[model samples]
Structure formats: C-alpha cells, structure tokens
Target: MAMARRLVLWGVLAACVAAGAGDWSPGTATFYGGADGSGTMDGACGYGNLYSAGYGVNNAALSQTLFNDGASCGQCYLIMCDTSKSTSCKPGNTITVTATNLCPANYALTNGGWCGPGRPHFDMSQPAWENIGIYQAGVIPVVYQRVQCSRSGGVRFSLAGSKYFLLVNIQNIGGSGSVGAAWVKGTKTGWIQMSRNWGANWQALSGLVGQALSFAVTSTGGQYVHFPDVVPAWWQFGQTFTSNLQFSY
Candidate 1:
C-alpha cells in the first residue's frame, strides 16, 4: 500500500509565508531586558539562556495573538521601526529576532497593557529594540514580517526528566523554526510519539535509557526533518546533542 502523507494541521503558518520575506504587517513594540540582554534569561519558551542557546541578544517575547500558546517559539521575525507612525523610528533599519518568550496580557494594567489579548505586539530585547528605534522611545510602531531563521549550526536537543519520563527541548532550528510535532525513536524500539509540554519542550512517557536516540520533527510551516541516532546510548539527563541534519526552509 502507498504511504499516507502527514496531516497538514498548521495551515495558519501558511499566512506567514504568503508573501515571502517582504510581507510586512503593522505592530507595536516595547523593549525588555538590559542592554546586554542579561535579564532575558529563562523565558516562557523554556530557553534558559538565549546566549548559550546560540540565539544571542536579538530576541523578542511575542504577544498572545502571535505567541499562539508557545507554538510560535523559535520562530523568526524581521521588524523595522515604522517611520510613518513614530518619530523615534530609525528609518532604513531592521532587525530579525527569534520568538523566545511570551508578553502575557495584563488586564489589570490600563495604559501599559500593550500585550493584551488580540493585540499584535513585540516585547523585544533591549539590544534588538535599540537596533531600529531610539532609546528614548519606550514603545515604537513597527512593521514586521515572518522570516526564515538563519542558524549557524544544526538543531540542538537538550535532554531533561527522569527515567520514567523524557523531556526534550528542541532549539537552534531553521526553516519555520516552530515545531508542530515530534517523535522519538530508540535503537531498540520503534518510533514513539511525543507531546508538547509547554514552550519548546516535548515529552515522552516511556524511558529509553541506554538506547541511542533519533528524532523526527515537523515544523509549523509543514517542513519535516529527521535525525538518526543523534544521541548515543550513553546519553544522560541535562546533556545536549546536536544533529547534522537541518531544514533548509
């Protein structure tokens, strides 16, 4: 029998690439973290340290509408300060950043609730914000576009959890960046499906210790990549492994 194609469940991501890299949409932006992005660690996407994760200081926490409940984690966006809407905009400048956190809504705050539900906003890192807007402009209007992530290396999987459970954090992804689904396979066993456990973490209930690990990942943009025996049988918790394979987008 012929094999069935994977289901296209994340059709929303199609809109992101509808017009390619030049497709810009209106939005608002504010800065967070210190100038060096030291305060941007341990974000909602579970990326403990952006610098260590190879994301550097150029990152942003997306508002609820764009965040899509962590599904947007790892996605990249190109944003330019809109000169037409704000005097503080530094024209001819744009910055690309990865989605690493959530700018949660604050219903209690009246004037400062730019991240409120349904709003398109970006709470960018200070360094990223300073790249396109004046420092004095606490918030600036911006035109943003979903862009492909250019990563320096292959995808990285950070392992955590106990013998009874396995929690994997996928990072350094290119292409669509956001993971839609994942499956883990052990050397001695067949492919085991994993479920999203918040942010970029995927979880598996069974333990496959002492067996080499492989992964099959599908991005929100419908791209798929597979890594075979990426982790040795001696893998341990808290250790990270890098795959030679990556999606080119």
Candidate 2:
C-alpha cells in the first residue's frame, strides 16, 4: 500500500507539471521599433533608452493584463512562432524577450487591450519578432511562457519627481527579477503601499522629503525582501540608492 501511495503521488505531480506546461496559450504577435515603431526611449513602464545597455531593441511591450501594471517589468518570456497557423514561421525557432514597457489599452481594439481580456499577445520589437517569424507577415501566431530573469548587480532605487509626489524606479533586480509589489515606510510613518506607475516604477503621494525610507519588495515568484533604512534621510530627488538585499530563485 505504501508503494502504491508513492506511485500515486508521483502520478499526481506529473499531472500538475503537464497542466502548467499547457498553460502557455496561443496568441497573436506584432512588432514595433525602427522608423514606424514607437520610440525606443520613454516607454509607458518608465524604462528609457531601450536601445542602450546591450538591449538594443531586443525588448517587448505587453498589453494591460500581461503588463500587470508594471509587475511584469524586467520579466522574461520565451516566445515561439506557431507554425501550425502560418507557413512563414520557422520550425522550432523561438526568441526570448524582456518585458520593458506597457502597450496601452487603446491599442487593443479587436482582441481586448494590447495584452488583455481574450488571449495572450506580445508587441515585440521588430528585431525580436524577426528572430522567429517572417518580417513581411507583420502579425503571426505565437505561444509564450514566463521565464526567470537573469540579472547582475544589486538592486538600485532611483527617486524621481518631488518630495510630495514620489516615484521610485527599481532597477538591477535579480532572481525572479520582476517586482510584484512594493511598500515604503518613513522614519515615523507606518508602511505605505506603493502603486506601480509604469515599468519598474512605484509611486506614493506623500511628503517624505526629510525622512529616511525603508522598502519591502515582493517578487513575482512570491519571494519577499525587506530593506530597512535603505535610503538615507538626506536622499534627494534624482539621486539613487542601492540595497544589499536581493531575492533568491
């Protein structure tokens, strides 16, 4: 009976793994960048100059739901052309892309928002799309799955806007690199939730000019890291702070 129970458990685990793999859904893909594309800098996710830092237009913009209001920023995805739908797809070819921006809801026209309601979709950079599908096809069927992001260096926090309206951009994240939620606390105040304003950026509308700030971050994989007093009281707008804390895979 014990041996039979072990086999049953193994069977259940295999079924779970199969279900997870089947979650990768078919979707439509479109490309941007180059003359007709959205500019490489100043994306809705607040990531600027996507062409720099060796990324070089190898990025993508996801629709509202997929964007998860910036939670998907810095996340990676494995995308493959669905050859079953089009002859232009290269058999067994796939391209991995980093989510760097948000494709606004207005662009969703036919199939929910750019990455919304109906099916999963990716607005990839032209170069990234061409890596797996014929350029002339414009749009092609694809299947995508979220993957772990590989990054180096510690996490850095960049402050923007004014003291009353604070915006913090988290960068150089590691492990399950995308942030799911972030909270901030000042010297004397209780923890305040920060709302995702765009790619990698979390914002809070409060006067925190003179207080030292501590942060707590949760990653997509449910790992949490609390950075106590990561920012000094003297931290000023436009300045950046680095924390020694990081999430593990």
Which has the greatest TM-score? 1
Model 1 Cα RMSD, 1 decimal: 10.1
Error of 2 at 35 (Å): 8.5
| TM-score, candidate number 1 | 0.89
> Cα deviation of 67 in candidate 1 (Å)?
0.6
**What's the lDDT for all of these models?**
0.85, 0.74
Per-prediction CA RMSD (Å): 10.1, 8.2
**Which pairs of residues collide in model 2?**
45-199, 63-115
TM-score of every model? Answer: 0.89, 0.75
Could you give me the TM-score of model 2 versus the true structure?
Answer: 0.75
Candidate 2 lDDT over residue span 1-249, tens digit each: 445434543454345457663245667788887643346455776656543322346678887768776778877887777665676665556687888877766674665545565446788888788887888887888877776666544677888878588899887566666888899999989999998876688999888998999999888788888999999999998887878776774
lDDT of 1: 0.85
